[model samples]
Target: MSETKTTVFRDLLAATKDGDWGKGESRQGHVPAYVIRGTDFAEVRRGCIAGVPIRYLAEKTVHRRLLRADDILIETAGGSRDRPTGRTVLISQEILDAFPGDVTCASFARFLRVDPVAASPRYVYWYLQYLYARGDMWTHQVQHTGVARFQFTRFAGTEEVPLPVRAEQDAIAAVLGALDDKIAVNERIATTADSMCDLIFQSRAQQHASVPMSRLLHPILGGTPDRKNESYWGGSVPWASAKDVVNATVGVLASTEEHITETATQNSRAKTLRPGSVVLTARGTVGAVARMVMPAAINQSCYAFEPGRMPAAVLFHMVRSAAKSMLGMAHGTVFSTVNMKTFDHVEIPNLPADVLNTLNGELASLHQLIVSHLQESRQLATLRDTLLPQLMSGRLRVKDAEKIAEEAT
Candidate 1:
């Protein structure tokens, strides 16, 4: 094994600074610039990074703070009990090319540019990911009030990291990066398939008759079993919330963070939705939709729709297309929310039986392809995650890890 040395986090960084805190007025007349938020950081995969459509700022002010290809982003604030603070991701050249516009992260995140002479940024990123997976990042977090904050200065000044030679770092990074690259390719394939399906559905929607959602589908509101009751939680039944729907990129929810007992389902309004039922977020993040791939109970924030005549695939898009209007219906001062009444009144395109069948036949294969890609990506991610700690800690050699990764891909 090559000799490895320990170094402080700050010594490896050329620069470290918090992102722009200014929430300037929207780019009404100015050029559009992308702004990364903490939520965006949370949404991305553990070792990957990408911007999300959350907020925009004036290009003039944000141009100075734009992220470079070598920069690393760390979530400084905002984390749940389950997900502790100090989540990190690496910005790559490919990401910069994808969004060519001026891009800067929001106030809740900090950016660190690694010193090329001192460390390989990709190696540092993978190490951070490994630390997070092992729950070591939590030891550097400080919880006050209710929010968990990453102790940036303390972490940077005192935290020790294993520093190998640059060549070894690059080799380790390459092994892990290969798995991520494959996952990225699969993600793009799934995204393209979904977009194609949506375009096809839009064209057919024009020829279909319109009917109120109440008439076309049966709506079942979700319920939460009392959190205080120990018996109500942790059973065989998978219980989904808005967060689960948000994470379900394929529009087919396969798993959830929390599970509920059968007794809880019977006691509450939460019903075990059958496979093919369309699940829609009716509160908080309105109109976020996913199809149930397995039997699961949903929380009060969601609505499960049993297809009357429409296929689940078509119904998923229908709700998705209506998301903007559904968001507009949200009425609350504390939190934006929509209810069953709003969905009941909303109208959706009603295709004839033959047309529905034909569309389903054409689109079903595309949907299946997407699901397959997502499943494959998940498996690859698991493998990459398993190898991360071993490679970083020198438990596995870079050449051996590379061979294993190549075979997996």
Candidate 2:
């Protein structure tokens, strides 16, 4: 790593206000189209729309500079450095075609105008993503709470970029790009799987009696101990809340963000949830569902419903099927919430025991297939990520990669 030559971000790029770019808000009348920008990167993700708003459109197309296929959108201020920073959507021809009237400019955002004379735009975009992910772009920077902010002006001002030869950049981007494409495909498959499950459950719900969650299973509430107590949250158990489960589509729990100390866990009222227990988010975008893969602690905003005389997968999907209804019933004085009674009265189909077992077996097989493809997609992604920087730097040769791919085939 010591041998790697490093370049500060500011020194390698320039923020050029192409006289053509127009702010999106001004597009009041011209066939409204829009793009969203928010603190959470996941907001732009396929299904998340809780707090994001798509407003207005490009005011003038002819006078304003249009973003081309390769242009990169950079968020300029207000985000935790480690998470999705101001950097955002990489424009593609397909995206431009999809939202022809939409474009974003200014208001604390800037476009990276690559010195095409010096580096390839694709190569630079990849480098920016790497910098964003590694948190190397912002090491020591001041963040003013309310004022327009930027860190390390050098990140936006530099003109000289270290770029691998064009051919190398193409090869590198291709490898990683292929992996991303596969991931996208897998996501579509997952969507299909979810749709199938929804159809199956909707049919069941319409034909079967409706019941609250509490009656079908025992409802357990979680508590958070005092953070000041060292022993409470320090334990190895994972403590989850509505925030933790909000948009999670799969897996028991993600080890990606936030953790509790055993001291905090012990001090708080949060209770431990068993691995197979169904987890339901009870407030603030309530009724999102997931199951714990391991024993973990949950916050009060989340409810752990342990299944009794029910198949785990069947119950999991059952709760998931009723998430919207559960959310609709929530009533709170200050914050909206699904009360325990909602779960207590939640109705589910009283399938014959044999039918329940059959459905469980069928779903188990389907889930296995979905998980397998997802795992393969992830593995391909890991391989692509491993090769990205090295390929970009010419540290690894394309010929060798081709050879490896051949051998794997």
Candidate 1 TM-score to native: 0.91
Q: Could you give candidate 1's per-residue lDDT for residues 292-327 as a string of tens digits?
A: 878999999988887557777777777777665677
Off by more than 4 A, model 1:
26-32, 42-64
lDDT minimum window of 10 residues, candidate 2: 40-49
- Over 320-382, each residue of candidate 2 has an lDDT whose tens digit, in order, gives 876766666678867788876776655666666776687777666666656666666667657
Q: Of the candidates shown, which would achieve the greatest lDDT relative to the real structure?
A: 1
Query: Any idea what lDDT model 2 has?
Result: 0.60
Q: Residue 287, candidate 1: how far off, in angstroms? A: 1.4
Clashing pairs in 1: none
